[model samples]
Target: MAHTAGGTALTPAMKIAIAVIGVLVVAGIVVIAMLNTAGRDGAEAPPSSAPTTAVAPPTTPGPLPGATPTTGSEVPPPTAAPGTGLPPLAAAEPLVAAPLPKSGSRDGGLVAGFPTSVAEPMEDSDVVSTSIATENTAMQVSLVSSTTTALDEIRAHYRALWTSLGLREQPGDDSTMAFTGEFESLTLNVRTTGTGNMYTIFGVLRTE
Candidate 1:
């Protein structure tokens, strides 16, 4: 053994002990490092392949229970009413004043066997309006005022006049009268106006 200044040299036993302690420490460190690496790998590993719960989308509202479905086409038009095919009623015009057989003395009066009469020539009595004649038919609407003649008397007068002319009376009520003959037909409608002293008469005449 050699002695240095103020120091002693180490023995082989002491060196062996130190070497074993270092080996033990290194082994412990390696074991701790392996445990830490295992913990980290477990935390960072990919998840399992099992199916996940799926979140459903929100729902939309539907139509009411009894609602009817609409179509793209347009609705159909309404049907026409019954008995609307007759000619329209129009206002009367001036008369043509053609000569007629058996006509009344009044200037605008009906011809013999006709349905209506012109207003009598008196104060405030005149022909109001007449219709233009077609090929074989015409109409006249007039207003007649009389202080002496009642509505019943005028109606009766017309009835008697039509019967005397050999025109057969068609079935009608008090407000309407119809007469037919061999070559002509007539229709008369009368209504009282203004205190029952004036009467409006509408007549249609047709000739063969």
Candidate 2:
């Protein structure tokens, strides 16, 4: 038998057992080194893609710079009324101021609806022309005559007739007299023409 340095004698079985333990130790060391190397390299390497999620920015929309915010004080303009086609302030104006239509007379004839009894040619006066018409809801009657009667006489004649007809006298000069009442208006004028004094009677009545 061969004696070892520590005084134990070497045997085949003991050597084989020792050799198996050395192989196992080397295999364990190699596994530990590989695990350490993998951990270090993974820690040092860059990521293949961006971080899955980073700090996100604000997501709400805000007003633009210098834009004004609503304050609930806005208003719209008012609409105007539709037109009526009459003159301005036409309703408020006097009836005499209203526009009238034109009229021309025919010789010595009475128009339909003329009040011949009240406003015909004076006694002994020759009727030269007469006219009657309607305009703007009013009635107009006119008479022209040649009279030898003086202005004073004619005035007295019509004044009595007007008084009987319930017509009140309006302002007048020596040449013209005006009377108005009961929605009726009249003017009598005596003018000196080529032949003689011409007496003209013009009247307007409210047709209403």
Best by TM-score: 2
**Every candidate's lDDT:** 0.55, 0.78
Q: In candidate 2, list every pair of residues with a backbone clash.
A: none
Give the TM-score (vs. native) of candidate 1: 0.34
In candidate 1, stretches whose alpha carbon ends up further than 4 angstroms from where it belongs are 1-126, 136-148, 197-207
Per-residue lDDT tens digits for candidate 1, residues 1-208, read 7788979878998899999999999999999999999999999999889898998855854555777756733367898778878798554332223343332424354334343433222344444333333342343333343334565766676667667656678998877777765544555555666644444444434432
Which regions of candidate 2 deviate over 4 angstroms?
1-105
TM-score on alpha carbons, each prediction: 0.34, 0.47
Error of 2 at 85 (Å): 51
Question: What is the per-residue lDDT of model 2 for residues 113-165, given as tens digits with 9 covering 90 to 100?
Answer: 56675587887788888887777767788988887888788888888897777
Best by lDDT, which number?
A: 2
